[model samples]
Target: MPRRVAIIATGQTKHTARRLDVNIRELITEAVTRALQDADLTMRDIDAVLLGNMEPFEGFLFPELWAVEGWGGYMKPSVKFNTGGTVGTTTAIAAYYYVASGIYDVVMAVGFEKQSEGHTQTAITTVGDPIWERSVMAGAIGNFAVMATTYMHESGVTEEQAAKAAVKARRNACLNEYAHLQMPDITVEDVLRSEVLAYPVKRLDMCPQSDGAVAVIFAEESKAQRLAPRPAWIRAVATAHEQQYMGDSPKRLAEMRSLIAASRRAYQAAGITNPRKELDVAEIYEVASFAELAMYENLGFCDRGEGGKLIDMGVTELTGELPVNPSGGVMSTNPIGATALIRVAEAALQIMGKAGRRQVEGARMALATGYGGNAWTDVMILSQEKP
Candidate 1:
């Protein structure tokens, strides 16, 4: 017997470099209130809460316990999970389980990151062990740069091909109302000529730190029918964790073994054969231009090492075969811990036809993927109709 879970409500705050307008409680309230309105329900309708966050980034040990009340959890059952960048998607899966397992009728899944309030780079640097790896690794961008070099060397991808992805993302970001980075008139030549941050990775090639919050309501099938006219249902979800050390495997090992394996299980469970043909839209976690190209191969859109070809041919653009990261993706609006769940939420919004100007045309099926912590991975398949 399979249980059914659907997202009946979705809400988000404006993504910005710094949010001095509201406190944490106010930010939480803004998203939750909007979700309730979208579901045509009230706070009283929620049965539990699941929060996703990376505490170290905010220098707070247990912000979830204190912020639960603001998320409308109050005395209700509430808990938070931290899994590097996978926290958001991981939290959403937990909320869905709470509903599908008959433990809760409605669960509020929320993820937020106020990078402006904390030292994000220092927090990210701590992901690697301080004994050896931390001293050598510059940080996320540095690690990504090394990986990008490997990708270029292996796949024979030109720097200009990867630069195109950056231009497309910033262009898409301009259409995203909640997006903080908007470069409507950007071009590949512009990214190629931008200031280099970490060799292959340029200042313009990387995503910006953002302060934002996103909330969605997960309801049992019966409750979903009463909440919204149409709901984006969760068909299949899978999570896989890899070794913690960066040197444990080859440079691109995580992309193939951890990320791709989880996606295979998710796609198989969702009855998908060809992702390029089956998925109408996708929101992937690609913090850099090369990562997006690598994702095209990892997600089965193309063969291994052919990801660069996909970008060069303009296959990932909004009007391409499969519209990817139409909401500008993590590359355009990264909120770190909230990024994975933002992918999930953005995909759901596309399926619900609520993505505004960034929405894909006639999108019926969508996918969202999360990758972080060197080895941790989570892939989720969502649809306008159930599997």
Candidate 2:
């Protein structure tokens, strides 16, 4: 049998459009230090260090080579990861595997990105296949806009419903200290009236590029008990990826095949029959408001095409039965490389009873997701009890 793993601590820096005061290396250190303090442990307690970042977004090559000290990986085994939008959670999942495999007792995963330091659009454009996807989708916004349109047509989800999701995210963000957007008074009207980025995807409907860092500590079952009063046990994790080109599947966003498969696999492994009622909270990488609606269907939070109805009913709100994105989600604070990892960290925080104002009351089981890299996805389940 595989050894059990649990998340002992999580740390995150204030997310903002810019972090001019500190370099990327310093930003990395801030989250790492906080994770160590949160766990009440030093570098000596960590067996290895793993980092996740979008190297192109920061215009840095071999970032880990120079920023080793930032992650406290000096003279210790270390690794780096970059999987587009999924980098953060991918890092956490990899660390979980390391500890659960019994090869390492404790591991730290860090996700960082300094979008202000480089041209995100240019860097993103460079990632395309240069021939196929470039013609089908202009860029990230264009890609999602097309996806949102498909969902709108298929599900009959109205613009009002998407705005409601934006309203919920921004309002919830006000209660989170590390979130980038803090629009406490934002309303559906505000989202509807906001500038349109691409068709149905309005300014508020989309997530902003921000600079931030997040870190989480994973430990073996025995070490987790001593590291934190309440450890968030890893229940199950799954990853799925679609074909690299959008031309291969134009209905990618509407179908969300990767998310559907990954989430189902995770649910099966976690022994969850009904996700809508069984899971307490979710921290999904909802890159856009419409994407969140689509996710509701794909994640089985609601029947297909009923996502609009679910949001309208406020089923995923903070006080809802199964509150989702109580940490404001990706729409509220997105640091690209660190965005998906924030989902894991926030979910773990909920299980640890340290989510403070954004705490899902009495949360026991949480679902976290990461979505990026040609429509790939990673889903993880965290439980308050050993799984």
Candidate 3:
């Protein structure tokens, strides 16, 4: 079997709608330095650097080159991956493979994005098929709006249920110091009254495009023992992809097969059958409230189509049966490329017993996941102890 790989350290910058005060290199350096500090090591100790970014949004075609020098990746092995929103988690998983393959003892993964630097709408719209879908689909929001309509109809989820998730995320953001949108006492009624971006999905339900960076350090078990007193071990990692065309999918558009398959593999690998009963917490990507609801059902936290009810009952809140997205989640602050890594970092901190006010008491096992463009999904299970 491959050697055990674990996250010995993690760090993230405070998320904001715009980070005009700092340049790209400076932003990445901040995250990298903090991660190394958390690991009690210097940049020289890192054997490899895996950068995750979707640079088209920033108009920087070669951001990795500019980022490496500032991030201290002079001579170390380095590579970049761009898998839409899945990039961050995929970068961390790639670092795991590097350590698990015995090629590197210590690896660093960094994810960042500065939407304020360029035109995100143009970048997102470019993903559509130039000949067809681009002309009809409004954008990612419209694409998801279609799915939301299907989810609400087939799953019997009311608009109010989706509103509850927005309220929950906004409330949780108040507890997260690094979160961009920290509304103290947002109510479901507030969400319902919020401006409608698309039918069924209100402005509150959509994630705010932001700028930030997150970094994580991975090490083999032996290396981790030397570096961290309580490493957050990676119990399982899986990724699955589906075709992008909306028409290619069958009925019930929100029922993502990729996420379902990935979740099952992750559960098996982590030896978790009943996630609600076994896992202590979750930090899932919530680009929209509907996505979170669908994830709840797809990840097996509840029966199919029951996720909407789960949110309305406050089952996914910080004080609920299984606290989720204690860090405020993407809906509260979405840094595109960095959002998924934030999920990973938040979950890891929970397992390490380091989460501040949002910490779940006695959290030992946690899960984080990513899902976005092209119907890609990546699931990661983390534990306080080595597997």
CA deviation > 4 Å runs, candidate 2: none
- The sequence of per-residue lDDT tens digits that candidate 2 reaches over residues 1-387 is 779999999999999999999998899999999999999999898999998999988788778988888878888888899999999889989998999888999999999999999988778877788865665555588777877888899999999999999989989999899999989899899999999988988999988889999999999998999879999999999999877766644466668989999999999999999999999999999988998998999999999899999999999999998888998998999899899999999999999999999999999999999999547999999999899
Candidate 3 overall lDDT versus native = 0.86
Task: State the weakest 10-residue window (summed lDDT) of model 3.
Answer: 245-254
State model 1's lDDT.
0.84
- lDDT, candidate 2, residue 372? 90
The global C-alpha lDDT for each of the candidates, from Candidate 1 onward, is 0.84, 0.91, 0.86
lDDT of 3 at 168: 82
In model 3, what lDDT does residue 58 have? Answer: 93
Candidate 2 vs 3: which has more lDDT:
2
The prediction achieving the highest TM-score against the true structure is 2
Tens digits of per-residue lDDT for model 1 on 122-187? Answer: 788888788988887756878777777777887777788888888888899888888878899998
Error of 2 at 353 (Å): 0.6
lDDT of candidate model 2 versus the reference: 0.91
